[model samples]
Target: MPHINLLPWRELQRKQSQNKFVTILLLVVLVSFLSMYMLSTYYGNLRDGQNIKNSFLTTEIGHLDARIHEIRELDKKKESLQQRMRLIEDLQSSRNLGTQIMDEVAKIVPGGVYLTKLERRGSAIHVIGRSESNNRLSTMLRQVQNSYLLEKPTMQGIIAGEKSSRLLSDFNMEFYVKPFDKIGEAKQ
Candidate 1:
């Protein structure tokens, strides 16, 4: 064999191998960085879409809540109006109660009895009257009992008096006025 120097060729070969290795490492790093960027962008887009959907749902819920509140307010107002209407109807129906009571009292009065004063408090009527005899007062009480407008006649007091030189009895009595609706039902 000829005496050949192979060190230079061996050194060149080692350098070339190192260059190739460095280039492959750089390519791998670049590929990994690109993949990571793509994955991050995809996740960001998904998060943005979820946020938009959530915002829309929140807005819709707010509108529905407002409508529910309005409906509740309207219901309350309707109830209040209905209550007022009922009160007005009651007042209108009971307007003739005084006349009915007076008519019943006039019909029950006998010839020898005279009403002095009449007082009403709540559902009770206070009747002060003068009668010629106790029998006349008894008859008046019986008439009051049979009347549709009055009931529960109670004698509070009785005193002897002189009217036109004849003895008379002054009396105080209380009677309860029947409710208008009950009176109508009883008549029917």
Candidate 2:
């Protein structure tokens, strides 16, 4: 137990412990910083990937929207063409209506009945005529009523008149033209 100065040895031991503690603290701090950087970079990459996917979806959606618009336009055009076709069909069906009416009138008039004027009003025709006898005029009316292109013969007026020293009765009559579909069906 000689006097060797234990205070200096204890002081040196304290300094070494303090240095070791500092080194371990520095190591812990470096490891924490590296981990935080790695985590942040990984999250950033994930965000970038998500953004790319979102952009792709957006572009595809825009393309699909454009296609849908084109489809709508095509549908409208098709509908317009269909309407035009229907109009043409209607015109074609009614094309022979006037001819049919004239032919029917020629067949329906009796020999003693003369038609002076025939005027059309929508689906009805007003006829001005002179007849030799009431019986002849009535026969013409019966024929008109029974015609495939005519219907509903009605007498409007009758007047006794002299035409070129011949006995004639001036008369006014009305009749309806039969529907085109019905006329076609009846002829068939």
Q: Using TM-score as the measure, which candidate wins?
A: 1
After the best TM-score superposition of candidate 2, give how far the Cα of residue 36 lies from its true spot, in angstroms: 36
Give the worst 10-residue stretch by lDDT in candidate 1: 161-170
> For candidate 2, lDDT tens digit of each residue in 144-176?
878988999999999998767469889999999
Q: State the displacement of the C-alpha of residue 23, model 2, in Å, after optimal TM-score superposition.
A: 47
What is model 2's C-alpha RMSD? 6.3
Per-residue CA lDDT of model 1 for 67-141, tens digit only, reads 999999999999999999988977887788888778888998888999999988988999998888888889989
TM-score of 1: 0.55
| lDDT for position 82 in model 1 | 99
Residue pairs that clash (backbone atoms under 3 angstroms), model 1: none
lDDT of 2 at 85: 91
